[model samples]
Target: MTPAQRRRAAEQAARRLARTSLFRRARHLALYLSHGSELDTGPLLRCCHAAGKAVYVPRVLDGQRLRFERLVEDMPMQRNRYGIREPALRGARRGAARMDLVLLPLSAFDTQGHRLGAGGGYYDRAFAARRSGGPRLVGYAYALQQAAALPAEPWDVRLDAVVTEKSLHVFRN
Candidate 1:
């Protein structure tokens, strides 16, 4: 997709997310900044801020785990080893269990809620303890990223829903 197409699709997906009850009821949310051709979260971030929600972004810890840090206005940012931008200043952090919602980035996903991340288990490991209840794990991606099915492992964490530019797919409660 071209830059313009990406922007438009991101906006559309953000709107779909904003209409979800999960998002509306969420007071604390986690969102990842776009890296490479991933769907942009700038619009969603703005929407969360406008709605007075507390937003957090993932930060790599010890090169093996992820801890979310609150996103503050004008906070210093630095690229991670994977070239993903994260808050530079370490502030109060929260685990996935504490968030009301978490919008994850994915390379590909299936209707079964299985997601193929960037080959890293950061999100999976971060939210692994959450099986039935806790934060709503949602995948943020373009419609084209959806696949018929994807392989899953014992440690893979399923998403509650996935929001694409075309629509929203809820896999489970």
Candidate 2:
């Protein structure tokens, strides 16, 4: 399918998820700004901002490492190395707090709950390191990005749920 088609599917899915209890229950959220091929988060971000919740975005720091900084109104944004736009905070290397919810960008995800990232493993390491007592990991993907299978590695952490524009795929522990 075309990029537009994929994005449309993902956007619809996100809209559906926005009405869910899980999304409504979240008080603190960490979400990504959608670029090419990722699920659109503009609506979700606006909702969070309007709700007066603390919103954080990731800044890719080092190899497979990312730092999350709180985003306030009218915060300056910068283009990161991955071409994703993130809120800029100079000299702000504070560790990510234990968020109530984390919205992940997914290149691909499987029915079995495996996620294929952008091949940099940034999300993999970030989730692994922060997920011990952190928020629920939710993979945001277009329905077309769902696959039959994905190659799993040790550092490749599993998600608690995968959200498409259609519905939430909650994994059983």
Candidate 3:
């Protein structure tokens, strides 16, 4: 899809997501900034800002760990090792367990909610401590990113749902 088409699709999906019970019930939301051709999260971020939800973005730490830092209007940002813009404050941190909902970024995913990320393992490491009752994990991506099947490793954390431009694919709870 062209850039304009992608933007439109992202906006449309954000609108759909804003109406979902998952999004509505979320008090602390974790989202990723768009990279490459991934679905742009700008629209979703805007919605979060307008709705008064506490939005957080990831910052990569040592040992492939990720810390969610609250996003504020005046907070300074910088590119990390992978060149992703993240909140510069390393002091104020929130663990994955504290998040109400997490909108994950993925390269590819399966119908069963197996995610193929950028191979960084940051997300896996961050949420490794989570039990079955942890925060809600949702993969956000374009519809074209869905795969028929993908191999899952023991450490691979499956998503609870995947919000695509077309629809929200919820996996078994």
Tens-place lDDT digits, model 1, residues 85-169: 9998898888789899999999999989999999889998898788565899999999999999999998899888999999999
Candidate 3, 69: how far from true, in Å?
0.6
Report lDDT per candidate.
0.92, 0.76, 0.88
Worst 10 residues of 3 by lDDT: 86-95
Off by over 4 Å in 1: none
Clashes of each: 0, 3, 0
State the lDDT of candidate 2 residue by residue for 1-173, as single tens digits. 67677657756776776777767887778888889857778767777777777788888775567887787778888888768898766534335547778888888888777888778877777766653656778888776778899999877878888887777899853
Candidate rank order under lDDT: 1, 3, 2
Global CA lDDT computed for model 3: 0.88
Q: Model 2: how far is 42 from its true place, Å?
A: 1.0
Candidate closest to the true structure, highest TM-score: 1
Assess candidate 2 and give its lDDT. 0.76
Report the Cα RMSD per candidate. Answer: 1.0, 2.5, 1.3
Decoy 2 TM-score against native: 0.85
